[model samples]
Every structure is written in structure tokens, then in C-alpha cells.
Target: MRLRSRLRGEFPRGWCHSAQWWITGIRDLTLNTTAAVATVVFVGEAKRALRHRDEPRTLARLSGTFEGYVASLLVNSGGLAVLVTMAIEEGLPVVLTALLAGWYLPNIAISATVFVVVARSRTRQPAAWAELDFVDQHAPKYGRPPETIEEYRAQQLRE
Candidate 1:
């Protein structure tokens, strides 16, 4: 009939005290943990994309950017409802910690897929650093046809 009596038997007598202390620590950390993790992942991905933008595989960088954005958006948004449900079933302190961890953890995984694809492409791509320089030479100079694209390809292929 009494909640306290029922909870006492259902859980150990000292569980409430320990859980309360743990929840207090969780509450202190919830928002900070979420923001720090999400920020680190986003910034790291952005940095990688920027640093590798000049890589031969243009499509890889483009797709990585798009995929990371969409995945993080979907996971974080979808996890909001789960967070709310958890808050109701559990408590905010506990649920928020779990929510932050579970939500962004998968985001890292999803982004890794993009990174791996790009990395593999890098490994397979032929070493041709002058590809862009060849394209640059095509710019008309003083009304003269600077060079043909086929000629540029032939040059790089010869190297």
C-alpha cells in the first residue's frame, strides 16, 4: 500500500542513498558531457574534411560532409524522444547521462563509415599531385588556348 515500504523491499535499503548520490553527480555532468562529446565529434570531422578537401577523391569528402551532418541530425533528434521517455521511466539525472552517451555514441559510428570509405579511396588513388595544376593551366592566357585537357592527362599519365 505504501510506496516507501514497497520500494524498500524491491530495492536494498541503502540503494536510495547511493543512487541519490550518483544521480547528483550525473546531474552535474549531463549537459556538459553532451555538449563536449558532440562538439568534439563535429569539430574533428569538420577538421578532417577540411584538411583532406584537396585529396583526389572529391566525392568522398562531399559525401562525408553530407553523411555526418544528416546522421548526427537524425540520431540526436530521434534520441530526444527516447531521452524523454527515459526521464519518465527512470529519472532525469540518470536518463540524461544515458541519453547523451547513447545518442552521440552512434553518431561517432556513423561518421566512421564515411571516414573509412574516404581512407580506402585515398589508398587506391594513384599519386598525381599535379592534377589540379594541370586543370589550372587550361585557363586562357592573353586570348591564347593555354592547353588541352587531354594533353594534361597524357602528361600526368607519363609520370
Candidate 2:
């Protein structure tokens, strides 16, 4: 049995051409789409780390650094992809391919630089994880665990 069924239908011929163009255009932006997705993932992880500071600061710091590296790579790659696409669409011929190569090479260099810089940077002074306490205090109904290990142990003993 086929894992998926292919649908067959007769549609306007113009629609096929339009669809092809649309797909090509979308394919052209693949780098940008990948970068954007990476950026979102990095930012989301960073936010999570920031909100749980008291829970192993080392892990939080590592996560934040990783997020920064990802963000930098995404931004640089996306920028390079945009430049290459513009060069191609403008019909730069052989120069277009050269420009694309130029853009990509520089992006690799930039990514390496950013990765090193982010890795060497210190964790935020206030730390994002510290913010968790405030949220826990304000959202009593959210079922936050006891703030301290002692408190947790005491609560467990009581039960």
C-alpha cells in the first residue's frame, strides 16, 4: 500500500505556471526561512532560561550563550541569502554566481566570529532565571513549587 495517495485533477494551465513561479520564489527564500526559524527557537530558549534562573544558573548561562550564537548565525545567513537572491534576480550573469559565493563565504566567517564572541561573553548580571520568583509570587494559583529546598522538604514531611 502507498503511504500516501496522490490526488489527480485537471486545473487551468495558467494555475500550473503560477504555482511553479510561486514555488520557485519560495525556494529562493529558503535560507531566510531557515534563519527566521532558528532565530525564533533561540529566542524562545533564551526566554525560558531567563525565567528559571534559580534552577542551575550554569545551565541557564550555557543555554543563553547558545541562543546568542544561533541568533547571530541566523541573522548573518539570512542577510547573505538576501544579497545573493537580489544579485541573481537582477540578472548579474556570471557575476551573480560570484556574488552569491562572496556572500556565502563572508557569512561563514561572520558566523565563526559571532560564535566565538558569544561563547566568551559572560552571563547576564541579573540573570533571566531570577525573574521566575516574581512570576511565582504573583501567580499563586499557578501551582508553583516551594521556593526553597528546605520549604519543599518541609512540605513533603507534612504530607
Which candidate leads in TM-score? 1
lDDT per residue for candidate 1 within 1-42, as digits (tens), equals 268533433343455466654574465465334433353444
Which prediction has the highest lDDT against the true structure?
A: 1
Check candidate 1 and list the clashing pairs. none
What TM-score would each prediction reach against the true structure?
0.30, 0.26
Q: How much is the lDDT of residue 148 in candidate 2?
A: 50
Candidate 2, residues 20-111, lDDT tens digits: the string is: 54664465355345433333434444444445433444433333244445655767677677777867687557776676666555545544
lDDT for position 142 in model 2: 18
Off by over 4 Å in 1: 1-58, 61-92, 128-159
Q: Model 1 lDDT vs. the true structure?
A: 0.49
Model 1 is weakest, by summed lDDT over 10 consecutive residues, at: 137-146
Error (Å) of candidate 2 at residue 1 is: 46
